[model samples]
Target chain A: MISLTRASRWYGQVIGINDVTCTIQAGLTALLGPNGAGKSTFMKLVTGQLRPTTGDVRVFNQRPFANTHVFRRIGYCPEIEALYDDMTGRSFVTMLAAMAGIARAKRAERVDEVLGMVSMSHAADRRIGGYSKGMRQRIKIAQALVHDPEIIILDEPLNGLDPVGRKEMTALFLRLATENRCVLVSSHILYEVEQMTRQIILMDRGRLRAMGDVYQIRALIDAHPHRVSITTSRARDLARRLLEFPYILSATLDSADARQVTIETRSPDAFYDDLPRIVLADGYRVEELDSPDNNLEAVFRYLVKG
Target chain B: MVDLYLLRNALRDLASAKRLVVAAILIMGPAFIALAIRLGMGSQFDGVLTYGTLAALLVFGFVLPILAVVFGTGAVSQELEQRTMVYLLTRPVPRWRILLAKYVAAWIVISATGLLAALALAAVTYQPTPGSGRTALNRRSIVNPRKFLAQLQTPDSPVVDYVTQRLSAETLEQLSRWDPDTPAPRPLLRMVLTDLNKLIAADRRLYDPADFPEINVPDDARQLMAERPRGAANARLNRWLLEAAFPDLIRTNRTTGNKLYRDVLVLPVGAAAYGAFFLLLATILPRALITGLFLAFGWESWVPMMPGNFRLLSVMTYLRALAPHARPQTASTDMMQIFQALSPDTVPSALAWIVLAATTMAALALALAIFSYREYVPRDDAT
Candidate 1:
């Protein structure tokens, strides 16, 4: 577990992270943000690579900065792509496993096991310099997992992966979360983090914007108007029917296609409940129904302005 | 086990083929220069002078310090430059241990490369001179005391004031116009010998081994001590005194091969201090390589030349004390003589050893302390 109490980090006049606080427990919790959103700085604080400029960052109830005990319990995968180019991936993993205090007799087994988990066993013997970006990302993940840490913090871990690789890594993160380990992944890719977990801490401009389940966050932001698009032959009739409800803020009939109408309403649940009744009673032809505000992207867009 | 892995990783990085290539060039550079000197100046080549100049100016002064800066700053900067430091720093090991392990690896490399340069220079330039032969030492002393006595004839020697203080006015008068060429005035010669014996007994820095190469004492006194005849009667009594008087001139000349080995012994201690200083520099300043080079060449080059007690602050001064060598005179190096004249001070061998150890410990301790507490952002990540 990691906890940040009014944690703020600054690089000279530039802020890395502003006054932000959160607690992360055992599960795959994505840190959602855009570029320079202070995600990497936040992760660095938890991994003991940096000290918070003005707050208390505690990992497992101890300050993480230069604290070897805390370091042993946490594994960090940084965003930087550079590695010891001359070293083979296997040797790189072994070296880190040794640094992690893994016994020599079991280091090889542990290294191989992690390499297999990341699907890097085939290229494990090759020099890292020759590895593709996907391979490099996997190797980074492998090193983070080699020590069997209780908490794994990865910054932009899915940056360079292919579609298939992304899916596999996402699944791996999900499986890791299921093992009762705290997995905190930070990414600017909103869709990718959404695929990993609904549990997230959303940030923008170095400040925590929102934290909790996507639906839960969405439910809390009911004051924002929601858009619903419906394709029906009786677009005029449906618009008139939708306007009868007070929750409907506006209705725009699509001019290019006369059969479609888009309605804006603050209360989507009430709208959805009344929509089928209106359609069934009128005997109307409702060929398609869709709402853009139904998923994490809409929730994220609604939560953080960025 | 973690320490071992850290050392191995650092050593592997240091011994990379790319670095080895540069180190090879550094190691062979002196030998190549010596070859050119041997070929161009053949027969006229004073092996002692050639070896001394190259060893001091080229290898010790330039090569050694430059390597220390490159290797020292490179020890940690290399990891950060490659963005590999994050991996090491995140491990369950103390930051100081990681840095110290890398420093030890860099120190081993700089010391070895410097020693090789010195050895290669000595090997290429070494020629059997008069006192170089084992049995030849008994017959031909490196110093021709007759020539020395002729040079010492001037009355206003460094000893003029020394004798005015220690001897009777009568003895000073007899010693003033002395000459070894003319038929001997036995009593005056005996007086000169006795007075010289007093200087030897005093254990003064006037003829310090470190100063022997530079030979900066006032003309008269330096002339007397530069080389003395091993008169059968005086040899037994004065041998130890003469050696202690100017060991660099006597020992380095008699055993040319060991000069480099002796330099080898001193090189690491010097590198350790220089390396530790650079390690500390890298920790405090981001542009440490540039700053270190400025300090290595700009500060270190001239600080030992600074007037008065200021020379005591330089690491180079102590290094010269630990392993004195003949600093060959050249137009560019005339600044060294000027500084030597201005600061006629020398650190004793025992003191040099102690001070170097203390400074090295101090620098490493400070570097370790700063590294332990501070945070380093990977350069790419910082942007």
Candidate 2:
């Protein structure tokens, strides 16, 4: 329900987002990036908080920059931690709900309903200044949801949540997505988003790097030669034998470890499947096996570098 | 709904205990001074003169402007400083409506503080005027004879001419030796009053009421008794008749404290003008508070006394027009009063009202327009 056409923003000479085009539909979609990867800038554009310096941003086919119609349809949870410290969570939610044009008859009910949704009902009447980071996160999300907008953009919403809170929030996002609402969540961490959705738009250095299913992106990362390290008394023998497999691209012995052999292969599944057979046949003792490619950081490294 | 919430939040801030304490402190400043004056100079108290000068110099010129700058400008800057603006701006309400709502709150605060300060000054200094003892007279109410005494000390005052021909050379020397710059002791002023009173009463005998058939000698007697007529009487009989009117006129009275109400009433208008201008400045400029202080204290302090119609440019000028103060006999050399004390000008109250209203509306409209179009996204260091 949101689209960006060659959207780019700059702060003086520093680039925030550069020449990025993307469309977000009604479902769960994670914006994945490292810090300074323009994810927040992209979120601000979609949420109508800012206009792109040289591009078009549309929400529901209308430009979203300071447009009330788009604003009424979109909810935003910003990454900024500052909140109205003196106000109660309920008061904060009620104020925003009122501004969101919720009728007075339903404003209080909606504020309460959203506070419950974020599991903030118990402490809703307490001043937000006394709230912990997790409570503050929940309240921010509560305010965003209080308006009942069709599209919700959350920037680093999971940053301060504990494991259970994170899990609950992920489940909440999953439920919202199932209801056919557009939920665009941005984060620098991969595993946090991995729990919520398979679809992700990866960005790095102000440019869109990849966009698709999480596994597909992983597969794209895997297409490059993957490294698997093995430790054994006969490391040189295993290196010599591992080359017989057609999928194994190369094998090199670790210079510091006499018993370790590192193998490179484009087909990780095939190499893994054949390694046990090769070791069983050769009767070479294998003590340990490890793959650096299992990590998303390593995946980003391989993809972003390429 | 948006307007209600915005206004409520702004009012809530004003209702805080900290603000209450600040209000108490500001109002006490004028109260204590009035008390000290009333106690120090008991029977000789002149509330009109005191309230007139202090209200104009302190309340209208200083307190109102400072309060407007802090509260009015803080309506926007405080929100931006705390980064709470993002929440307000990102809502479904139009930007201008939000700013207008907040401005209303600031205006109320500024007007209320100014009103309370004036009320405090008026309450402590309230006294029945010494002459009529009923109606509170303004700067024009020459309740005190010192003003006339000061008038008589002038180089070619007609009353001085009238007195010179009658008094001994030694008494004339006392009148001459009494410097107008440094106010003469109270006894010396009374001595001048007694002489003038005696001479004018004696002069009235020169023309019997029956002799002047056209003059309404009984009813117009008090009216003529009120002021020193600046010699419109060149004819010998007219001069004698003019001198005849001085008996009741020279029976000088001190000003009552109740006269401060007009000065008090003019403060809200001043608040609106100052509040709107500074509110606009805060929205447009980054360092608006400092600029506002300079303008309020530095620019407004002197523009009203800039030798000509230049007072037309200052908000203080219109306020002064709406609530004019009686100039004190003693010359005040402070920067706030230096120019205003030296240069006295008359402004039509109607013109002051129209200009103030127009300036306030124009500033508010510009502030609303700027707030609507400008991007005030509080910078997030994270991104």
Candidate 3:
């Protein structure tokens, strides 16, 4: 497990990661935060690349910096564009494996396995300079796994991948987590993190504002009234049908158009699951349905305010 | 044996820098040969190109310092810049082993290539022919009036003779065609001495069967005389010329003898000087500035003579003092003036280099330590 206790890091006059104390359990934990929210800095601290100005960050109960023994269990994917462009992917990964003290006989096999895992097997013979951004990201992931690390912490691993690559990576993360190892992945995109793992730790301006599964964060957002809008040919019929529902506290006709209706609901999940059925039963033709205030952004806005 | 691994890696990269390796060989080899040929042709047709000018040309001017800078830093800087060092340091190897391995590999390659170039230069310039041989042949002979007289009017000599009645009418008539501002030729006494040297070929039929094959040339004779027993009379008129012309050349040969024990053994005391400069630059300059400085001064300033502003002048003097073995001092003011001018600025240059080397090793150590502590997975955005 990885734990940060009152951990804070400051650079001369600027705060990097502020007073973050949290336990990351064994599983796929998505570290979700916007840019400059201290996600990468926090990852660096946990991985021993940067030291905290105050407090403590420990992985397996040891200081990460200069602690070679702890590295046997942890893997870190840094957020820098640093690589040996001259080295072929296979040779580079093999070298890394050997450095990790893998037996000479197993080194080549381990390198090839990791290359295959990241779908870089065919291009493993080529120098990393020839790789595209997505290919490079895959090779990076391959290196991290060459030693078969117990905990893999990837800092923004999906930044340059297309949708197909993202899906493949998301699947790869799920597979890695299923190996009964801890996987901590950080990203600024809420939707991206959400697709990878339900377990999340959220931050704002270097402070940890929330931590839990997606449902728990959704509950925090649910406590506030969620705005729901509906557009239909018979909008009046849908608005009148929805007025009796107690969960939706208020309703208003949109000013610019008579064909749309907006409702304020305390429980958006209930409104969403039931609205379609009611509309269908009432014989109303719903042209559009949207919950404008039901995403992680609204959740972050609410929690940051609180 | 990660030391072995480090050595292997360093050697691989150095071997792979094809253009640089070729450039080194091409520049040093031909330059040495050309210098030897020039020296061989100019009065001392000696086969050996062991000129102080040549040594200065190869070491300070072109080869020695460049090798040190290129191999010394290139041995490890490429890994650091590429961030490949992260892979090595993160492994279970000791930091000192890494340094030592790299040092050894760079030293071996630099020493080997440099010595080969020096030897090649020596072979091309050192003359072993009978007439143009390594010794001073002291027998006096009459010089042809016309040939000997022409030299006094040449660019190198300051003295001029304008007498018109001392020669045959044909000789005088030939001389009168010369410009008046130019000196009338005078016969220069060509003195020569002899010493042991290898002979690869000889043509007995070329000269008079009764005459000695050894030719008398003052500069070559003086050089041969310096290595002879003290009781021998120097046959050359220009002992001062020989002394002035050959110190830097002799130092290159002298320094190679010192290489078996020292770390940077390119020039006699020059490795220490250049290394000191590089160490200082590495220390005070930022990462970007280091590359800029190396490209600017390192490549552009391939001068044969040592610059006046070089750092480590004192250390070079100390090295010069401590070289081979201590000897009684010779008090030639001209030599002293040259040495004094070449001496580096002691306080700042020495202190700066010491700090620079120390700090570079320290920074490298810290980087290694940091790398060892974690496994680096490539970042998504970094791609």
Candidate 4:
């Protein structure tokens, strides 16, 4: 739904987004990065707020800058918490709906529907200035969704949300994706992004580091050592047996608890497959097995650090 | 449709802003001062008119422009400062529409406030008293030629020769028919005398008999020879002087009042142009308020005092060009003389409005273009 070709944006001497190229399709895709990692810059570029200093950015095969037709199809929720404090949430959303070319007769209905989707209908009559942080975030999301655009781009939508609000928002994003809408949400929060979708575009220092499903990204970096912990009473025995596997780089008994063992493996898949077999053959009691590098955090760490 | 929506939103926001209250207060300051001066000093309608003109210069010229800067510069800058500009910019509406809508919103507020103040000042300062003969006469006569002539005479016996040389044949015949012994003057003579008096008074020194040596006489005669007789010719000459002066008086009063009226009418237009100018400045300069203040108060006020067409750069010149020509007496007033350098020729009302309209359109267009092309990054609000 959105594409960038060698797109770069520079703010005088400061680089906002470098010469990075990527395409995003319809789905709930998380843009993962650390602070100042050009995630917001990428969002702005795709949303057509900032033109790339070089190359091009296109949405639906059209340049989005001042393109009203393309803009009608795209909804952007900026990261800044700037809102008209004097206006009620409903009015704010309705105003945006009107600007989006929603029929005047239907704007109220559209505003209500979007506000309900974000679970902000109950407090929609209240001025945004008096709203809680989570409520403000919800209202911001409501405005972005008010027009029912094909592409919805949110930057740090989960920044000020409570845990329940986050859960609701994640579900809303999932629902949007299910509706065939392209949802690209940018965030530095790993767990929230993981909860939303495995499809992600990771960035760092104004450069795209990796893009794809979290596991696929993780799999690509399997050459990096993986750390696994085994909470078993027979720590020394497990450690000694683990050394027998050629894929296991090293193993050691936990310092605080002799019952626990930690192992580094060059191949985590081979280590897991051999673990149950050895336990069954030796009749050894296996309490628990946990791979710390199994999730997106480990994947992000590897990609960003490497 | 989008422009309408944006304009509606901008107007709503302006109505809710606390700064608008301050702007209204600033706009009314001149009216209040005029009221105070009118009531405290028991001044006449003419005094009120003069006060209104002075108010236009100080209030509309200086204060209203500052108000425009305050409202206009903040129209966009406030949104950017608060980081709320994204909401407006991200909408499907065209960028120019957003800018134009905002500019119109600010202009409406400023113009409405300024015009209200102007109307109030005009109403307060123009309370005509009921049928006072002296006031009527004051309005009818351009100059009291009798009083002017008396002021010009000294203890010199040559006054009759001077009067004979200056007066026209017709006026002299009329004067002679009433009292030929007093050396009657005609219309041309009266005009020459008036012109000479103007030249002599231009320097504002006392009239000296030494200036005219051809009409030699004794120094004991402190008054004109014509004053010694109470004759029909004297009365006829006085009647002729009135005839000569009335049309000019009526013309001066009408033209001056019309000019004042025009200035009042164009205050709103000037306010809108200033607002747009400030808004344009705000787009590229971070310290737009400082620049607006410097331009409105420092540059606009000071530049018009400068000689040559260089004053054309100031917006005040255009506004002053809409003012009426100053009457000689009023022009000679101490306060009016202080601002004499700043006064401009009275352009036609239509031409003045056109200049104001063109200025406003140009400023708004520049502001719209700047906003459309520029990329705005969210800045720290605390800074």
For each candidate in turn, the TM-score is: 0.83, 0.78, 0.65, 0.81
**Top candidate by TM-score:** 1
| Cα DockQ of the candidate 1 complex | 0.54
lDDT for A229 in candidate 1 is: 92
Pick the DockQ winner: 1
Q: For model 2, what share of native contacts is present?
A: 0.61
Clashing residue pairs, backbone N/CA/C < 3 A, model 1: none
DockQ of each: 0.54, 0.47, 0.17, 0.46
Q: What share of the true interface contacts does each candidate keep?
A: 0.68, 0.61, 0.24, 0.55
What TM-scores result for chain A when each predicted structure is judged separately against the true chain A?
0.89, 0.81, 0.86, 0.90
For model 4, how many clashes? 9
lDDT of 4 by residue, B1-383 (tens): 77887998878766765786776776677778777876777733354344445455656666688778887887887888777888888888888898888888988888777766666666666644332212122322434443333322321234434534454555444444443234324453355445433332332222233454332211111111223313432332232222223222221222223444665676777777788888899898887888888888888887765666676677776665554322223313364344442332223445556877898888888888888888777522110
Model 3 agreement with the true structure over B180-265: per-residue lDDT tens digits: 45543332222111110100011111112113212211222222233332322222212322212222211111222222233124
Reference-based lDDT, each prediction: 0.78, 0.75, 0.57, 0.71
Docking class of 4: acceptable
Ranking by lDDT: 1, 2, 4, 3
Cα lDDT tens digits for candidate 1, B272-298 = 999899989988887788999999999
